[model samples]
Target chain A: MARVVVDVMPKPEILDPQGQAVAGALQRMGVAGVADVRQGKHFELEVDDALDDATLHRIAGELLANPVIEDWVVSRTP
Target chain B: MRIGVITFPGTLDDVDAARAVRYAGAESVALWHADRDLEGVDAVVVPGGFSYGDYLRAGAIASIAPIMTEVVAAAGRGMPVLGICNGFQILCEAGLLPGALVRNAGLHFVCRDQRLRVETSDTAWTGDIEAGSEILVPVKNAEGRYVADAATLAELEDTGRVVFRYVGGNPNGALADIAGISSADGRVVGLMPHPEHAVDTLTGPSVDGLALFTSVLRASATT
Candidate 1:
């Protein structure tokens, strides 16, 4: 069995209000060193060792992340 | 005319949608998400609600419900389909519509009587209304902002598929003030606001939303 992790984030051009709200709260709490924060989603998948990268990519792109507003990174996990 | 109102597990507006359909002089049929059959209704309404507790992204899980397969098939054959609020999110997730509905730009749930301009009357839901007419409807959602690639926005604008636009001001920071849009064939429509809530003046902000249900009924009568 193989494990894969996919991190999906809003495209840079899209607005992420939840991240902005969290960042604001942090700043109010005097976290001075904090920069901007963008919220995202993470998914862990367990697949057969024979699963191909193309199929994984398709799953992440078509079903896991919405291409209209999000970009995803899929990487195998040890 | 008969209109099917689909109810997912967490659907909150199916009853309201059916009420609107009945008020518009059409028979309303209830459809279950677990069932693949569409009940041969002339049209369908995917009402608003946080289906599946809105986990794993809004509408992401509900879009894959068994009934959506039949809804997609009916839509492909030019049957009118109206998706409201979370239903709109499902449509986007189901690939039946363009764009994605993300968290509200204000990071809060907005609920109020929102004014909207009827941008296009060519679709099955808006044909009864005149172009550029303004109507009052309740808008309520936590994640209702519409987003899309620039190219898709351009195409929607160029093709006149934008069915409704926020009139007074931008409510959820949706790009270009778009409130609702139609598919390329103008048979499928998805919108963030809750038109079903405005179907009765006694229980709603106004009766203006009844036009949407009547429009489809009128269209079916013509054909």
Candidate 2:
């Protein structure tokens, strides 16, 4: 079996209120030098070793993330 | 006329939508998410609810349901389709409409009777009413904020595709206070407000929403 990871983030141009809330909390907690924060989703999938990268990418692009407002990256883990 | 109301696993407003269809003096047919048949209905309504528990994203999972394949094909042939709340999200996910609905800017679930200005009477679903009319309907959802790129937004505006705009105040910080929109051909429409819940006098804020159902019935009859 192989493990593949997908990290999905809101497009930079889109507003992310959840991420902004976290950034606000950190500032209130006295954390300094925090410029900005953005929130996203992370998915780890276990698939057959024979599964190709293109298929994994397709899954991540089509189902794991919405291309209209998000960007995703797919990577494999040893 | 026979109108089809689809029920996905987590759909909560199918009954209400069917009731609205009946109130409009049309036969209501129940359609299942797993079924590929439309039962020869003239129109389709994708009602509100947390379909597939809103997994992945609101409407994302339900957009690809077996029934949607037929709905998409029917819509492509100019059959009138209405999508409400979560249904609106599903339509956007399914590429039946433009833009996407996201988490509310206030990060809260809003539920209340909202006032909306009808922006256009050109769509199959809005033709019964005059343009620029105001209607009171229930708006309820967490992920109702509408967003699109500048070019798409501009095109929607320029083409008069915007169907409903929030009046008094914007509930979810949706871009340009857009509560609903229509396809270029004016057959498919999706809105975040719950018009199905507003078809009755005793239970709804106003009877204004009934016009939408009547409009579609008339549109189906003529076309």
Candidate 3:
């Protein structure tokens, strides 16, 4: 079995309304210098260890992340 | 023919959702929020409603419902999961699917007969339909805008995972024009539109929404 980890995020074009809302609340609470707030999810993968970085990257980019608006970072772990 | 419809505290649509399922010739099994059993149903519908009263965030609380354990497990086992407005919120909150449903970008309670284009019909739910088909359904929500990090959107679009998109009149989020998306597996589908409200031709803007349910039936048979 080939184990590949898929970590996904929202696209750039899509708005992180929750993060933006919190940022606004923070600004109102007198928190200064909050340049930006982007929210995303992180996943830990336990893969077969046979697939190379390129193949895994293909899955993450092509089916895992929406390149137009989202970006992802893939790493290997036992 | 048995379909499980879950009811969580503050859920306003579970009854109607059950009725719609029954009307569609399937037995509707009412599942409680705190219960973990699915009652041996063939499929599941996480119907729309104001679960947990949209507190914290819509579907945020309901996502953790006790019954959600079974719902999530069943969904993973290839049971078709359809999340409506609030249900869509739960799916994202539960991490069953990606993206969050935030308040409408304009910050107003948007209620209207919205038109949608079915971008992909190849899923455990939408397998009977053709891509690019137009569907008219009702949408009512104060917080229904979908948000996610950039990379997630690309993967959804690139893989035909975006099952539905709003008609071209309004751009997505007013920031851009995105409507709804699905996971890599077609079994789980999340969309902002309310297909339940449009299931009956006489009771809705159109009967096109019935196709969504019937499509699921077809998908189930094919599977």
Candidate 4:
């Protein structure tokens, strides 16, 4: 089985409030060990290499991410 | 006004946006992401959906397309522009609007009918509605959260640049209830909700979204 991995992140200019809030919550919970938290997304798909990069890119733009707020990366293994 | 709907490879709502423009008495022209010409259209719409597959970033890859380069120039020349969802992302990527869109607090895909107040309606696309008027539209997105720095947010609020505010009681919890925004000159508008989905009374969530399209009609007619 082939393994596909995806990682998502906010654009550099965009603020990440959720990550900030979580860090704040961690601090409030008396956990001082956390330094920072930037939230993102990751996905893994098991698929054959029959799909080309263009087709896979189309899948990324069509449904996996909003394109407005998030970015994604896809990798496949032989 | 002849409106051009820019369709990137993964755009999901260009057809709907085009239909909404037609319903508003404007001719909808199809524009491809790679083309440089806008075909003399009076306005341009960067419709919603995944462009370049949200790879690299939402609107990031599509922002570099040749057509977007021209769209930016035309926007500089005062052509009215509107972006919804993914389109909003591209606008930011292209630097036509300030700030950027970020992830939702909950990290889950959200889909539902949303309520939004007309925070600023002096825009070319929103002028028909009075400020503070509430309207409903459909919002379906995974990264629909709107994030800008405190300074920028303050500036937006002080200048009344905000075009729409989320009505808060949504089925999905979106922050600050922000739904849309406009450019400094009110020529460019962007929003997270799918106003096109609300254009038809029979199949739409509410006719409230139609006013946005109609407002453009009024602006074009008066101009």
Native contacts kept, each candidate: 0.85, 0.70, 0.05, 0.15
Q: Which stretches of candidate 1 lie over 4 Å from their true place?
A: none
| DockQ each | 0.82, 0.83, 0.06, 0.12
Give lDDT tens digits, candidate 4, residues B1-223. Answer: 7899999999999999999988888899999998989999988989999998988567878877999989999989888899999998889778888766656656667888888889877898888888888888998887667666667678888888888888866433344566777888888888889889898988888877778888877776766
The candidate 2 chain B region of ten consecutive residues with least summed lDDT is: B200-209
Q: Relative to the unseen true structure, what is the C-alpha lDDT of residue B106 in candidate 3, on a scale of 0 to 100?
A: 64
lDDT of 3 at B64: 77
**Pairs with steric clashes in candidate 2:** none
Off by over 4 Å in 3: A1-78, B171-176
The lDDT of model 3 is 0.75
lDDT of 3 by residue, B128-171 (tens): 66888888888888877776656776777788888888885543
Candidate 4 off by > 4 Å: A1-78, B170-175
Considering TM-score, where higher is better, how would the candidates rank from best to worst?
2, 1, 4, 3
| Candidate 4 global lDDT | 0.81
Consecutive 10-residue window with the lowest summed lDDT within model 1 chain A: A13-22
- Ranking the candidates on DockQ from highest down gives 2, 1, 4, 3
Candidate 4: give the clashing pairs. A60-B53, A61-B50, A61-B53, A67-B58, B166-B177
Give the alpha carbon lDDT tens digit for every residue of B85-166 in model 2: 9999999999999999999999999999999999999999999989998999999999999999999999999999999999
Looking at model 2, residue B133 earns an lDDT score of 88
Q: lDDT of each prediction vs. the true structure? A: 0.92, 0.96, 0.75, 0.81
Interface RMSD for every prediction, one decimal? 1.0, 0.6, 7.8, 6.8
What alpha-carbon RMSD in Å does predicted model 3 have with respect to the real structure? Answer: 8.9
